[model samples]
Target chain A: MSRNIRILGTGKYLPSKIVTSEELDRKLGLKEGWAAKKSGVKIRHVVDGEVNSDMAVKAIEQALKNANMTKEDLHCIISTSASFDQPLPCQASLIKEKMVFKNHPIPAFDIDSTCLGFVVGLDTISYLVEAERYKNVVIVSSEISSLAINPNQHESYTLFGDGACAVIISKSSKEETSSIKTSLIETYPEGVHMTEVRGGGSILHSRHYSEKNKTEYLFDMDGRAIFRLSSRLINGFMERLFKDSGLTIQDIDMVIPHQASAMAMKLMRKKLDVPEEKFMSIIENHGNVISASIPMALHEAIVQNRIKRGDKVLLLGTSAGLSLGGLVFEY
Target chain B: MSRNIRILGTGKYLPSKIVTSEELDRKLGLKEGWAAKKSGVKIRHVVDGEVNSDMAVKAIEQALKNANMTKEDLHCIISTSASFDQPLPCQASLIKEKMVFKNHPIPAFDIDSTCLGFVVGLDTISYLVEAERYKNVVIVSSEISSLAINPNQHESYTLFGDGACAVIISKSSKEETSSIKTSLIETYPEGVHMTEVRGGGSILHSRHYSEKNKTEYLFDMDGRAIFRLSSRLINGFMERLFKDSGLTIQDIDMVIPHQASAMAMKLMRKKLDVPEEKFMSIIENHGNVISASIPMALHEAIVQNRIKRGDKVLLLGTSAGLSLGGLVFEY
Candidate 1:
C-alpha cells in the first residue's frame, strides 16, 4: 500500500538529573575513565524519581507547541515505550492522564517492540492516517531505562539513560513530497533470550521474589551473542530494504540509528558502509534510551537542520525481540 | 478510506486444569457454594505452569487448520495479550518463537489495551490489511491470570482464568459481506488506578521485592470504583457506537462481549437493551480471561453456528485502562 505522512513536529525530553562517567566510576568502584572507555558515554541523563508519564507529557507538549496544535487536535495517542510507567492499563492511558491540558477521551493504546518501537509506530499509524480514520495522530515513546538498570551489571548499566519523545504527524496531500519510501521489520525470535529483564511478567512472576533469585529481576544479557546473531542478518536485510525501494545506501541523506550502545552503532555503520558523518548519534551524552532512541535522535536532527524537508532519512534499529527494523522516509 | 475484512477461522485453547468453584470454596476456606454465589463462575480453566506461548501456538494451529492454511501463509502475527509472558521483547516475538513450524521472519508486534486488547488488535490491524500491507493477519490474545492472582484478594481473584484465542483474518473482496462496519475506542484516564498490576514495570520496579511490599507484585483492583466509573460512561459510549453505524440494538445478531465478570456482563446487557440470546456468555465456565475474553467468546459463537456469514456481530468490552471499546462487523 502506498501512503504518505507529513511530519508536523518532533519533540523530546530528558530527565533533569545528569550522571557523569566520573560519578559512575565512584558509584561502581571502577577505575577513573574505565566506565567511559567501556560504554563510550561521558554523561547521561537519568531519572531520579520522576515517572515515565511526566517526561512523556513534557515531550508531547513540546511537539504540540512546535506544531501550534493542542491535545484537542489529536485523534489518538500511540505510546511506543519499551519499558513502561505501569503495565496494567498500558502506557498510553497513563500518558493521557498526565497530559491533562485540554485532554478528552482521545483513544489511546500501546505498541511495544522494545528499542525499535519508534520506527514501527510511525509505520503502523501511517495506515490509519492514510485511511482517514485519524486526522492528526501523536506517537509518543517514553522509556525509563535508568530505573531498569541493574547496578550490579556494570557492562550494560553505564550504557543507559532515561528519556521520552513525541512526534506529531498527519497525512500528506498530493502536492506534498513527504512520504514513507519503504520499511522492513523482521524478528529472529531465536535470539529473544540474549537480552532481557525476566521479572515483571507472567513467565517469571514478580510475586515469586527472593534474594537468591534477584538476578532474574535485573537486566540480563549475552551481549556478544546478540551482536553475533544481529550481524549475520543485517547485511542481507539492509540490502533488501533499499532494493525494494529501488535505492542504494548512498542515496540516503542521513541515518538515524537506535542509540543502542556506542560499539553496536559503530559496527552497524561500518557493516552498512554508512559514513560517520551520515550517521546520527546522541549516545555520547544520552546513552541508550530504549524505544525513545530513534525519535530522540530524529528530533535532534530536525532542530539542527541536518535533515530538512524532503530529506531521505533512514531509521534503523535492533531491539530485544532480536528484531531488525529499518525505514527510509522523506522528512 | 474504506476497509473490509473476512474472518477465515477462529480458534481457542484452554489450560489442562479446571478449577471449579467448589474447589475454590475449599481452597479459600469459604462456605459451600459461596464462591459461585459471589463470582458466578461454576468452573474456570486456570493454567498450571504451561507457558503463554504454548497455549498460543496451539490456538494458532487450530485457527490455521480450520482455514486449511499454514503459518507460512501469514504475513504478520499480532499478539494482543493483556498480561504478558515477559516484559522485555514484547508478546508477539515470544509467540513467533513458539510457532516454529514453517516459521520465518514475519513481522510481529504487540497491541496492548488490557482486556479490550483483542478488539483493539483487530481494529488496528484492519487498517494495515486493508491498505494491502499484509495479505493475511493473525491476532492472538493469550493471557494467564491465574499466576498473577493474589490469594488474599478473593473478590477479584476468583473471577479469572487462563486461555488463548486466535483469529485468522484477511481482506474481504468486493462481493463479500464480511466487513468491519464501525468501531469506537475511548479511554478515560481518570479511572487508571481502578484496576492494575503494580509490579512488573519501571514504575513499580520489580527488583524492589520485599516481604512488606508483596501486594504490589500481584493483581490489584478496586472493583466497585471501576464498575461505577464504567457505568457512568458506557450508556453514552454505546449510543455513540451504534449511532456511528446508523444502527440500533436490534441490528446486532450476536453480542460477543469481553468476559470481564459475570456481574459486569449482566449489567452491560441490561444497560444496552441487548436481548438475552443475542448476548453470548462463557463466564460461567471460562471466567474472565482478560484480553482473550472477547475472541474466545467469538470463537465459541462461530463453532456453535451462532454468528454466520452476513451476520452483524458486535464485539464490546471494558479494559484496565478504564477504556471502553466496541465494534460491529458483518460475519
Candidate 2:
C-alpha cells in the first residue's frame, strides 16, 4: 500500500537588502506610489553579494532545523528555480555542496516550470514518497529575480523579489498530521511567451552581446495579456479542479497563491470566494520571488499560526507556461 | 499493486553539418589528428540555425511515429536538457508550444542533472507511471552544445555535439512486453564546479559582461579531474547498486552508459566488467550530446538489433554533480 505524504516543515529566507516601491520608483523615474499603485508590492528583498545557492542553502538549513532533523536525514532533494545561479550542475547540487555533504549519496535534480515550479516539485515528490522510493524529501524554490529583470523595465522591476523557500515532506511520524489530498497541474504552452526572459538560456547568448540585444537579454512580459487570459479562464479551471477532487470553496480554510501581481491576486480572491484574511498575500512585502511565492507565503502563514492542524488549505498559481496548478491538502 | 513501465519506442536527430576532427584541429591551430587522439571523437554534429526546441519537436514526432502513436496520446512530457533554448517557460514548455499544442493540458517540465538528466527524467517518469498518474509519457533530450561552448576552448569544442533524442514510455499493451526492474541514482555535489559554465545564469550577466569573465561565460570542465574521481569511485558505486537490486553482472545483456567522453566511457566499461559488445558507444561519430547521448545510443542500439525482448539492459552514467546513476530493465 502506498504511504501518506505530509509536509513536515517549511522555511523561507529573504535577502537582507530591502528595496521599497519608493526606491524602485526613483530608479525607474516614476512618480511616488506609482510602483505600489501598479503592482501592490510595497517592498521587496534584494540580494547584495549572495547568489541563488546561498539563499537556497539558508532556507534548507532552516527547514531542517524546523523538522528537528539534519541534512544527512534527507533521502532526496528537488530544487525549483526561475532565476538560476548557473545552468549546469543545477541548484540542488550547489545546495548540497554548500550544506557540506559532498559525499551524500542521494538523488538530486532541478525542475524548471517557472513560478509553478514549486508546485510541480511538490507533485513529483508526493509520488516519490508514495512509491516508497524516498522517506524524506526536500523541495526548494530559490529565486534571484532582482538579478534577472532589467532595471529599466518598470513593470517587472517593481514586481520581482529575491528569496528562497524550502519545505520537507515525509511520512507523518505522528498520526495527527494531515496528508496530501489531491494535486492538479496543467500546462498550456500556447501561452509560453506570455511572460518570459528570452535570453535566460541559449536562445540568446553573451557571445553575441550587443547594444541592440540589450532588452532581449532581460525579463520581458506581456502582463496585460496574461492578466486578461488568466482572469477569463481561472474560474473554470478552479471549478473543475475542486469538483473533481470532491472539494468546494467552503471546504478550503486558507488559500495560499503565487503573488503574481496586485490585480491578479485581487481577482483570484474574489473568484475563489475567500475572505481577505483567508487569502494569503505576502507579496505586498516580499514581491514575486518566482517559484518561491506560494511556498514562502505558506511558510509565513504557518509561522503566523494562520493555519492549524486539521485545516484544509489550497495552493494555486498561474505560471510562465500559462500553466495553472493547484494542490489541496489538510494541515 | 504498482504497474510496470516499458519503453515503447525511441528516436534521435543529428544536425546535418558534421565537423570532423581535422576541421576542428585546423580551427584550433592544432595538429591534424590532435582532436581525435586527445578525445577519441572523430566527428560531431554542429547545428547552423536550429534551436533546442526545434530539435526536440522533431525527435518527439519521430518517436511518436515509431511508437505508432501521435501527440494526443501522450499524457505527460518530461524533457531533460543540459543546453536549453530558454530558461523561463522551460524547454519542455517551449517544445509543447512549438508542437502546436496550444491548449493541451498535460504536465510538462524539465529536469537538469547534466548528463544524468535523462536518467533522472526516466526515474521520475517510472514512479508517475507506476502510480497510474498517466498512461503514456514522452521524455525528450535536446542539446546545442556547439553553441554553448566557447569556440576557443579546444577540450570542450571537439568533445561536444548538437543533437536530440526522444523516447516514448508507457504501460505495455502486450502481456509479453518487457518491464522496468530497478533503478539507482546517487549524487555527490562536491564536484559541482568541476564541469560547469559559471556565466550560464545570474551569477554573471550579459548586462555586466566583461573581458575578464570570458571563460566563465562558456562551458568549462576539469576533464582530468572528473575522470580520475569517477575511475576511482565507480567500482564501489556499481557494487552497491547491483547488490541492492539483487542482481549480478551475468544477468545483464547490454549496458547503455552515457557517452560523456571517450576516456570516461572506456574507464566505466572496464570498471563495470561488461563485455565490449554489451557496452554501447556511439560517441565516436557523434561526440557527447550531453543528456541526449544515452537515449540516442539506445535508439541506435535498438535499430541495430543489439538486444531483443526479455533481455536485461542496464542504463548507467556519471554526470557533472559527480553523480552516478543506473537503471535496470528488461527489453
Badly placed stretches (over 4 Å) of model 2 are A1-3, A173-177, B1-3
Candidate 1 per-residue lDDT, tens place, B146-192, comes to 88788888888889989999999999988997889898899998888
Kindly report which residue pairs in candidate 1 clash with one another. Answer: A200-B200
The local distance difference test score of model 1 is 0.87
Q: Global lDDT for candidate 2?
A: 0.84
TM-score of chain A of each: 0.97, 0.96
lDDT of candidate 2 over B55-160, digit per residue (tens): 9999999999999998999999898988888767778888888888745688788888889889888887788776777889999999998866877778878899
As for candidate 2, its clashing pairs are none
TM-score of each: 0.97, 0.97
* Alpha-carbon DockQ of candidate 1: 0.77
| C-alpha lDDT values of all predictions | 0.87, 0.84
Where's the lowest-lDDT run of ten residues in candidate 2 chain B?
A: B172-181
For all predictions, the C-alpha RMSD in Å is 1.6, 1.8
